[model samples]
Target: MNKSIVAGMLALALAGCASQQPEQPFTLTVAHINDTHSHFDATDARLELGNQALFTRLGGHPRLQSHAESLRRQAEAADQPLLFVHGGDAWQGTGYFKLNQGAMNADILSRMRLDAMALGNHEFDLDNERLAAFIGGVDFPVLAANLDASRDPHLSGLENLRPYVLYEFDGHDKERLESMDDAGDDPVVAVIGLVLEDMAEISPNLGELIFEREVLAAQRTVRALREQEVKHIVAITHLGLERDQRLAKEVNGIDLIVGGHSHSLLGNFSNLGWDQNEPYAQVFTNQDGRGKTCVVQAGQYAQAMGRVSVTFTPDGRVSQCDGGNTLLSDHAFFRDIRRAEQHRLAGQDAARVAAFIEAQPNIALVEEDPALRAHIDEQYKPALDRAYGEVIGHVPVELKHVRLPGADGQGSRVAPLVAASQLYWANTPAVQAVTGRRADFALVGAGGVRNSLEPGELKEGHVSLELLPFANAMSIVSLTGRQVAGLLLEAINGTLPEGAHTGKFPYSAGLRYEFSETSKGRGYLSRIEHLADGRWQKLDPQAGYQVVMTSYNASGNDGWNTLYTAQQVLTDRLDLAFVDGRLTAFPVARLSKASGGGTQVHYINQPLECNAEGVRCNTDAQAFIDYVRDQRPVLTELTPATVTLNRL
Candidate 1:
């Protein structure tokens, strides 16, 4: 009797569902920075203005605070939802980190109020205990969906360490966008963290933790978020731009990817003397072929901030995305800051440079936050100044540190010099006597040299605090010529893929090679030679040669697997001590087991006197400083290219 009534009821219900409107499209504005790397003070930057070179100060955490506050106010006034996120790498770059470790980073970042930060590989530069301490101190969550820290003793119980965070915004009030365990019935935005799956291969201090493949972790998390009725998803990733692009293309639910790790300065900065052709916010079709994902990353060292606006459709797909990276610059400009008099830009020249900066959409003039600046000046700057203030040497010209050779066919101008320094240190009588062998060649990774050598008075701070900041122990590994060739091929091939991290690209002293990207087999590399007795000779495959490199590389991190497989590896931990009013390296001896079951003779930690006389011992930095001081106008003459690239 009720069949007709049931059919009518069903028809009415279907009509009601169809008539209901879809959820309203939401537009979100995101402010992001990546790879700040503990650069708390303003850094010198050069820009091309009006066909003339203009030197000015770029970003610092203080400037970042000021700029972020300005962006927050603007978003609030406009009634727009905004989020400030960091794409990881907030540790290990400058003297600030050397002195204060992650403590300073935690303090500054907590004050700036980041929504979330991805766990960068640099975060693992220290042990898990230290990383856990950092996580404990930060106000915001440190995310890594791919990281399984449950096995780690220190990070296992941390509450702030999470896979993802959920935010349910109420209208334009972003302050109400608090991290929630559940979003109830409201439409929610999920921020997921993804890190490199090969984290251990690059960062060696991750203790008892496991990292899942980034793609798998991201896909699984996005699917779970979607299952929970969360539509909008953003992935803050430490996987470099290339991997981020892959993540965007492979995963369907991610609406945006904020990334770091390769320190890519995305956007068009041609006007500023830097050429970056990649658009800041690039949109890609998701694996499902229907969804769209937008990817963005700010440059390193807090120099630039990325602001992106994304319009999400009712279905949580990115319908439109627009944004660019704005370099944070100080108001002051200079013709040449190195010149004491008449170098400061003033009058008409100042006005012209200001006008140029103002006209550019990607440049922002910002002042330092007074409170942060004062804190740094009082609490941190003095210690750094006292430790690294003395003038070490001078650089006649800027020595650029490009990881890979650019279109000009010139690779890292600074890395080879650094390699030369390592070689010199390895051949020193003290080091040679301890190791029982003189190093034949020295290799340094591009990533090891943190910053470029600006043409000016080089300070002790510049070397230890900025340029070569890691203070890695030096290792001399005896390898056959065949193994060295294999090492170069592996390292170079790892970086040949587009957008790959070029840090692994090798730079060497006493060694040179030609690489062909299009060639196959051994043809990819040719003319492999080592400088012997002041002459270049083809590397004999059967000959045993002692190669000097950082302990990080000798352990097979960063694709230097051949070094780990070397027959003989000797390591030295050099501590800086002022012995008889001279900066001297105090060598210690110890032993450790290598990954390839080879014995690693290294030095263990020993307390040394770091008094007023000057106790600053880092083998790499000290060697470079010593070399520069001994050899004036260092890097003035261009040497034969260490790595010659043939893209064809």
Candidate 2:
């Protein structure tokens, strides 16, 4: 009587077990933005006039917000969980952010509703104090797993920012169809932020207070999330693509990595159906023994927005995935040629959200007031007066882009001119106020010259700082003529990479030399030459020559490690002191006088000397300065000007 009943009950129990199997599929969407360098304004009307209609508009927070909004809407319609994130560099770039230390940009950015953001290197461009002021009211959390914020007095309060956040979303039930759509299981999405460790070295002044950590921080963060039972993890990274990939490969449990810093336009690394053929390529993962990790980054300046859609089963394994990126600047009506694409992208009616970023009210913290701007712009007499001296001669116009004599395409043209003036000024009465002696040899590094004088009618006070604009100190160093020749050779033969050649190396107005690009080793600089009488002559390696140069050069910053190798006959004299006591007195009058009437510069290929006897064949005054001003035209002086130096 009991056997049939017992068997029926067992059968019912087995069927119930089969019906309880876990759900096998789920979908999530990720929207990534990076490197929005505080460009607030939109297009200019003048740019809209001509052929400007052909190009695409680019960058503005509002455009990015709009793109993000569009992505969110699509995700919501598709019944997917949407996560909006940033890769970093939400700091200084334009007059807007720089004017307020990112306060202005942050105010606008906070309103965009980002879930999480990584810290880019430029975030440290402002001191900790300004950084705090800038990010004080940010709504969303910033994740920087690598920055040791405790050491910095200015950044000490940043410890409150969460290192990562696990977002929980309830998925809608597909079974319930339209009516029961609200019923679903809760899913945990973990997001971690990371910054590069090299920020300290790259941005010394801004990061002086904090030290950066490395991959271990990321590893620890992932482990912590794992402990919290969160399996789906996304890393918001500003450590660059290479490092991001390495992190993905080394760390287990990282589901996706959104990267920045290299300004790359990536989609999916493999054929996950993302944009594979475009110039923009998304970096993928080691595939967890399967295929690609989901890595994506929109290019810099909010020019594009990246989207990744992933299908994950209840088993925590991603089943199927597909995604694409939309170019914010490629839409119609934004193609005005005369207008700046940035402004148009920010238009109120644009597809993306409008960025209502306002200028900082505390102007004193950002830039000088109008009066100060005018003071520096119209009449910088006090600053200039405290720099150089009374009028000497006068330049009819500013002499920009000066180079060393003879060292075609390799040496500096402007440095030599300033060095010449400083050395000449040292031989006068005002010199006693500083070193109490006339200058010997002058040396100026390539990095010192910040601006070039645009060709125009030179005027008094014009020479004031139309040339130099840095903390560079004018200095006098004693060098054997042989040492001077070696320094000149090193300055001419730079060690730049393959494609990074700028005509910014080389010596100043007084020096010159030649270089061979194809030669092995330091052969980049060849047959040494200098300006003497009215022609170009060979540099005598044996003679002891005194030269005036910048302190930076002597310290070896611009690939001039060879300079200090020679005997340090003497140094540490303050060239700024000379500039102060002598040059600062006359300001306008001194600048004009020093320019002197027109100096006729010429170039002669006739080669001459290295010895005291060969001095007779030197180039003329105008030829010498001309040779030093720009080696491009002095082709025949030293080595050919076409032998280019590449940057590594």
TM-score of each: 0.90, 0.55
Show the lowest summed lDDT stretch of 10 residues, model 1.
Answer: 590-599
lDDT of each: 0.80, 0.51
Query: What stretches of model 1 exceed 4 Å from their correct place?
Result: 1-22, 175-186, 339-341, 519-523, 567-617, 632-638
RMSD of each: 4.3, 15.3
Clashing pairs in 1: 576-617
TM-score, candidate 1, is 0.90
lDDT (tens digit, per residue) of candidate 2 on 1-648:
599999999999866643332355657788888877664432211112122323234545666666666666776676668888889987644434423446666676776778778877677654567677655668777787766666556676663355776666654211211111232346667788888764532442443344446578877887776665554678899876667767767766666788888666664322212234333334355535643456667766665677877766665565655665554442434444433556355454443212111121100001112332343334332444444333334333334443332233444335555555545544446443645554443455543453344333322223332233222344454456676656555655543322111222554434554455554324545565555664656667676555555544544434554544442232332333222123321111000101111111111222211122313211112222332333322112222332233322
Can you write out model 1's per-residue Cα lDDT over 214-333, one digit (the tens) per residue? Answer: 888889998888776677898999999989999999988899999998788898888878886688889999888999899999988999999999998776778899998989999888
In angstroms, the error of model 2 at 2 is 27
